[model samples]
Target: MSGNRYGHSSPPMFLVDSGGGHPGEHQYYHQQVLGQGNPPLVPCWTFPPARAKMKKRGTMNNGMTWVLIMILLLVFAALGLGAYQILRLQNQVERLTQEMPAEVESITAQKQVGLPAELIKMKQIRADFIGAHLIGHADQRSSSGTLNWETQLGTAFINGIQYHNGGFQINETGYYFVYSRVEFLIYTCSHKDSHTHRVSVLRRGENRTIMEDHQEGFCKSSNNQKWMTGSHLSSLQRFQESDWLFVNVSHPLFLSKNFQNNFFGLFKI
Candidate 1:
């Protein structure tokens, strides 16, 4: 309908019909309504930029919080497992301690009942096992002097015992069976009387002899070659620690170089 505005002919504008118009038409209707002293309508719309950024930040914070919670849960789970393992080990240790005395008693009873015969025999053999067997120096020529012994295979000592300087040094103090054999031979058969041979067990700086033996060689009045052998053995005799024992012969030059025939040995009994 035609309307009069300020005494001029003009079309009437209604804000209620502005919804059917374009943006420019709607703006014109708003201006006209404002000019008519009508209170302008203030539109309410959601501002996207600020709300979008806030929403994105909130989502990021939630994700980080969830991740932190998960990490804490994992850490706590590992700590719980460690504590449980420690407690289990402690329980096992206590159980073992509670049963230890009974097990020890059973072992004691078995020991008191006595060991097997084989074990006893083995122990006796071990106790009687310590000894040294030394042979005369094979490389040296037979001479009338004190015999010097070898230390390697041709001469050997065991059980912490050793031979040095023509003597056996005792390492352990015990009853030992000592023995020696010396073989004597001479190319010249000038001696008509029984060829005398003597072997003695002597210690360092001892006036008395521990053991000795004397033997006469088997020689015919017609035959010229002479040979004699003497052997000495001492029963289980008490010996002191670090005692130096050696074989002494009256005729050292006549002693044979043969190890099998001339050897010294001792065994603990």
Candidate 2:
């Protein structure tokens, strides 16, 4: 009957020890006393410690720096590769320009044997035959049927329907120039099935293009279907050196490798 028991409502929560308990710090708890005499305690709950406060700005900056470096390296590599390719292409163009001749005089000058009158005759006949074939009136048809032979030569002419079987004969003489015409001809190295510009001298015709296709190194189309006649060797006295320029021709259109099977018809105009 001497003391009255009073209950305490509010409790104290420390800033330093805001969490439930200090590690190894006695879990002592204090609350407010209301009326005085024997005070009754209220349950106390500890607050949580402040979470780690610093922002990871430095970490983010480092990550960004690394990314930028990688990007720059990639960019530089691409630029360098592009520059190298351009230089290579330019060098290639210059080399080709220096090594090859595009003009008629430059090309013809290469031949030690000058062009004589007989070359004109050969070109004329070849042109005529080609023209006929294009018009569907073929004098000789290629294996692909692009060309056809109309007549076989008689015994007097060594060069019969097949140029390889014989040579040719010439009875006229004069200053001559050699020129070639190509139709649907492909270089062996190129393995092409299309027409290309190419020529070669049978007896050192200098102005001839070695090979229309570059890959085949030094293979030349047969000049057998060709002709050569001139006063190049025979002086003015040999008004008409009896010479025969016979050619052996084959149809490369569909690859008539057994050239003998393809008989090309040729004659003098």
Candidate 3:
């Protein structure tokens, strides 16, 4: 230790040897006094060269910086991909919304255009028409057994036309085609005699004589039973509202209960 003039001890100086015995080895290390007074020299620590340590630190720092930059690039790429997906979804939703109103309007227009034809087709299916059948046996010869045939079949008339007392009363005025059929049968054939069957139509009020038909049959068997049929059809005849109409047969006793053999029908034209 060396004392200065101001009476403070001076710190020792470190000395590293520049001359060496080997190629890479240090020769010696010493402490040199810098003041005018000669002092005892002290040995000091010799630091190793700084190039290798600095190079190692620089390499570590460069590796960490590249890692940080790669992480930032990955984060940015993820964000961009997410944004692209969101934009695609938004565009799809917008396209569907734009087409929805056009589809709805097209369907509505089709329904509106077809409405009148559909109504007309439905009206044609339900119209004013009627049909009936005489449903029991009757006696033509006996006056007591001959009664008005009024019992009707299932759903006899439609559109206000009704069956009452063997007559059809009309509710609407229109031209109508009328038709009727009757079956006549007899158990005993007495001789070879000609028989006459008649069916006629009459309207109640002004036009009573509308139409009539006749059927003739000759007894072919000497003692066997005989059968005949009579049918009457009228052309399109004009009728009025509340008009009553019926069928009349000369021999009602021969009428069988078979509805297929005895029927009456009318249809408005």
Candidate 4:
């Protein structure tokens, strides 16, 4: 036996001669060494426990599960928010639909109330204008140097003026356009035959002719035949309140019997 450098005695060593050694001889020698009751030395190693590895794997699986659960929760929350917005929009549409008819009716009522008032205002403006139109009648006669007129005959009317005793009574003082038409008939045409038509105004018992027409010496028919003629007079004149206007003719018997042949009218300008 030899000693090691650490001053410890080494184990016993065996040397085999290889000149004619049999394969079984080596095994025999090792069996003889182990049979001495000395077991061979082996190294021991320490590793982590199986339960610790299993626990780590289980922790990883739990973390994955929690992540999946969080994703599912977030998806459900988004769906709920979308549903709330849709419901709010639908409610707004319903409210507007309910109010539409009343709004339309209110607008229509405003138009209905406004139109008639405008029409009535226009009618009042038309009525405020002063004018009159008078026609002749067969019963009308010129006896007081002024011809009488039919106030209620065919197409005869008076406004802002009055007819009193064969004259028009002015109610408003202003400028007026006065006009008259007279037709004449003659049974015999002869020399010195004449006719005159005049439009006169009377204010404060003074009579003045504003317009006149005279026709004479035109009766060339000598065979005593009937003749027809006409005279018309018009003028712009100024008057005061309570003034009277009248029409006069030189020959009353020659006046036409046809009522349509004579007319008189005036209007404020």
lDDT of all the models against the reference?
A: 0.60, 0.33, 0.53, 0.73
Error of 3 at 184 (Å): 1.2
lDDT of 2 at 101: 35
Per-model TM against the reference: 0.45, 0.28, 0.43, 0.52
Q: Quick one: RMSD of model 1?
A: 21.8
Q: Model 4, 1-269: lDDT tens per residue? A: 34568998657545444354675765665556544322344545555677799899999999999999999999999999999999999999999878774312222211323322333333357777566667666664556657777878666677778888778989999987677888888888776788899999888999998889999986886676888988877666888999999888888677888866677777676
The sequence of per-residue lDDT tens digits that candidate 1 reaches over residues 1-269 is: 33455775564444543355565666765566444433355565667899999999999999999999999999999999999999999999999878774312222211322212222333355764566666667654435455677666633544557776677777788876666666776655433434333334445666356666655434544465555544544444777787877666766766675665666666665
| Winning model by TM-score | 4
- Please provide, for model 2 over 1-269, each residue's C-alpha lDDT reduced to its tens digit, 9 standing for 90 to 100: 22234653444333343365663333333222222232334656643433222235666788999999999999999999999999999999999878763222332323423232223334455553210110111233344223322223211112211222122223344322223222332333332323332322233232322223212222244434332111111111111234333221334343233222223222222
Off by over 4 Å in 3: 1-124, 127-155, 190-207
Candidate 3 local lDDT, residue 233: 46
**Model 3 lDDT tens row, 9-76:** 87755334445344222212222344333334466665566878888899999999999999999999
Which candidate model has the greater lDDT, 1 or 2?
Answer: 1
Candidate 1: residue 193 lDDT (0-100): 37
lDDT of 4 at 160: 76
Q: Give the TM-score of candidate 1.
A: 0.45
lDDT of 4: 0.73
Can you tell me which runs of candidate 4 are displaced by over 4 Å? 1-125
Per-prediction RMSD in angstroms? 21.8, 16.0, 23.9, 27.6
